[model samples]
Target: MQTLDLAVLRTLIAVVESGSFAAAARRIGRSESAVSLQLKRLEEQIGEAVFVRNGKQMTLTGAGARLVGYARRLLDLNDEALAVSEKSIDGTVTLGVPHDVAETWLPAVICGFRRSHPSATLKVIEGRSAILQSRLADGQIDLAVVLTATRPANALWSANLPMVWIGRSDFHLKKNEPLQLAAFDPPCFFRAAAIASLEGADIGWSIGHASNTLPDLWSAVSLGLGVAVRTPAAVPPGLTVLDGRRGLPDLPPLHVSLCGPPVEFKKPAVDCLRVILEECLAVSIHAAA
Candidate 1:
């Protein structure tokens, strides 16, 4: 039986991610013809077409999508085995994440990293985006996942996430009354975005509840105390997202960025964590979409 080649799998991933054979060649530093040859070998070995053209874009075939997932696991295991042979990743790695993200997607990332680098110590700092960004800049944290209106200079991965109004399903807004807002305190990105969106549409609003923690804000919104602006990823089971049809102004998309220290200051453990974060978050985004 023929076996899949790791080099060909890498070429497949590069093509899928970069969106074209030429782009993938540039990314992996190979000639376009060589990239094509690698993909041809991959298809020959698997006996299936790996990609199909859709309009102006190239997308993975069913078999290709399945292979990509296994490819990632295979590559990760291969790399980790090599790294362990050299030296175990044992140094401390500090990661900072905003309260909302910490509640939603961070557990999987932490668990995966710990399992992969059992000897490495992980320190997680949870706070608002501004605080996390400040800590990252001060070298208080080695990596940060923060929400921003624009892309950060040091971002490793970033995605524009749509903001929604979250509140109890039964909650109703009385006409002419100020929209009751539940959000984090000042210096908070979500609060500012919520307020800005409201003010832009000349909608009167008042902070019915403010807290430094996401749980408190979620609790307030869930209890029907007020509506809170946040990403859909953070919406709890009891709370529902409000859209324009509900007479709420549309909140702008916020960038969820994974950032780290300068290139010179980055460590191997930190780099490993970065890859995990990006991979997990990319899955989340696709699932959400």
Candidate 2:
């Protein structure tokens, strides 16, 4: 009986996660032609086309999607078995994540890390991006995922995330009234960007609510208290994204960066978590988009 090759499955996953064969090649340290060959081999073994072209992008076929689900579990178990056989990786690795991200792809990262490094202790600290950055700088956390206007010098991975205005589905703007806004407290990047965009557009606005915690901010927005500006990653269930059609000014994109200690000070477990963060975030954010 023929079985699927693990290396080919890994290449398939890399292609899906990175959104292109070229990107998958770069990610997996293989030549572009080699990546293409592996994927072709996979299709031959599976007896189905795995990817179909959608305009300029390649998306998974229905069969491909189901296969990817199986691929992930297979790889997870394979990695777990290998890690258990090798000298076990053990140490406390603290991860810092901003409130927005903590709600979205963070859980997958946590689970993936735990599976591979079962002996390692993982601690998570959630706060605003600024606070997370501070904690990383002070060695309070081994790694941090933070938002910035520009990518930092030592980012392990970075992506530009578009920001959007969000409010309750039925929320409406009153004509000739100041745009009511709900957001985090001062020193928040999203809040500052929202205000800057409105001011630049000469749009009249006033803060309807401000809170330090994301849940409270989301609560106010969901209650139709006001609209809040944030990345599309973690918009609450009841809220809808507002656009130019809603008379909301377009907000600028923010950089999401994964940062960690200098290479000299980095531990093996920290490196493992870093890989998981990059892979999971790349896949999750791309799917969200």
Candidate 3:
């Protein structure tokens, strides 16, 4: 029996994610026919069909579902296997990240970096998007991951962060009552968004608490200080997403972005880090959404 091709497995993963052979082709930089041929070849190699079409949706067959899990594992091993030979990468690379992501989404990036560049040093600076973006532009960091309400032109990669209203379970908003809020410190997108959304809806609001970090914010929120906008996926365990029946204006999906130079100084190493972080964030945000 022939060995499973890594390219085919990656393509298959993309197809499952993209929901169609054509979209997956676009994602993996292959022609639709090429993707289809690869899938056929994969099925031939495995001696079982992977995907079966059901009405408008192409659902994965039992065999396909099982292989999907294996594909992810193999892909990671492939990345590590390749990174092991990378020579003499010993520079200190500064990575600026939002505080929220530093807690929830950064461990994967850090683990991948440590595995791939054992000799390299990574300095992390945590702040809000405005501060991170400014630092990136000023060359204070090699790259910065930030959250934005809209996708910008230079975003290396962008993913959806689902925004939700979060508050205590029994919290209720009386008619035209000022929206009590526990806001993140200045330079926070969530705070600005919540205020803008409330004001646009002609809703009065007051800042009941201000927090500089996730723990403080979570604490303030859990204490029923006020309602806040947060990405439910990254929200702390105690807070619950407010019911949509509350007549609150819908918050738009936050665009999580990675920003780096047009040409990184450490091109090869930086490229490796970028791909790892991008894929990690993609899977994370996709799951959250």
Candidate 4:
């Protein structure tokens, strides 16, 4: 446990950010065995294990998670120090991310790209999936990350994500009273599914809050305005996910898709962002599982 080498630190960050050593290998252009051995060496140097295997997945220990943020900052500084001779991957790439993902996974993706492609700016637009899709089609954004019920053939990658009912801890439901809901304006993936579930179950409901963004909806929920649907991983601090026993109709899982006709993108700026975003999202989807 002397000192953390720059190469090892980046490798450690890759494994945690990519959710698996194999995925990390692809991210860093290394073989799986190389990544594993590097991790082993990192453990020997630190005298503490960073990750624990869970069935086929690799879950970060508490120590590992703490190191992830530190590793990112370290690597960013490392890159900054080495930036003089490197060709700048600098450009503004417009990206649209779903509201849920923007809350949870988007920040890390932004950080990774900032560290790895410092001058390349990701100008983001956050909205409901449908709205994002429309913006993508209109070329208002270069890419869209959507939560969709069905996987589209053109999706670069996608993963199943479970969503839940969420609100303040003290929020309660009355059997005879309409279940109030807080959600984004219409054409939202969460809103549509939530509304459908209530309708299908023949539950009486009212819209207690409707906003254009996740924070406002969350603020409404926190105020005891109404319950809302969200992924457990993205639930705002102080909000509690409702248990099935709460009797709110269940919401189905959805796929988070990176909008793509992958072949259409050939620029380094686009490719770099695509890979960074993919890695960021992989961690989010798997960790939630």
Which candidate has the highest lDDT of all? 2
Ranking by lDDT: 2, 1, 3, 4
lDDT (tens digit, per residue) of candidate 4 on 1-289: 2677666687787777778876776676444555677788777776778888878788788888887778888877867765662366778888898767765667667766776777777798887777788887777888889988999666888889888999888777788999999988777778888989999999999999998877888899999999988776655668888977788878889888898546555466777788878876675565555
> For every model shown, what is its TM-score relative to the native structure?
0.72, 0.75, 0.72, 0.72
What TM-score does candidate 2 reach?
0.75
- Give the lowest summed-lDDT range of ten residues in model 3: 25-34
Per-residue CA lDDT of model 2 for 1-289, tens digit only, reads 9998766788789899999976775565444555677788789998999999887699889999999999999998889676863355788999998888776667657766776778889999998878888888888999999998899876878988898999987766677889888987788898899999989988889999988888899889888778999887656667888878877778888899999877788998898888878877775555445
Q: In candidate 2, how many Å is residue 258 off? A: 0.3
- Tens-place lDDT digits, model 3, residues 1-289: 4688766787799899989976775565434555677788889889899989787578899999999999999989987787666676666778898877777667657866777787777788998888888888888888889889888666888887778899888887888578889988787799988988888988899999998888888898899888889876555556678866876777878899998987555456676678777876775565456
Q: Which regions of candidate 2 deviate over 4 angstroms?
A: 1-73, 84-86
Residue 149 of candidate 2: its Cα lDDT? 88
Sequence-dependent TM-score of model 1: 0.72
Can you write out model 1's per-residue Cα lDDT over 26-81, one digit (the tens) per residue?
56544455567778778888888888878768878999899999998987886677
User: Of models 2 and 3, which has the larger TM-score?
Assistant: 2
Q: After superposition, how far is residue 257 of candidate 1 from its true place, in Å?
A: 0.4
Give all candidates' CA lDDT scores.
0.80, 0.81, 0.79, 0.77
Residue 91 of candidate 4: its Cα lDDT?
80
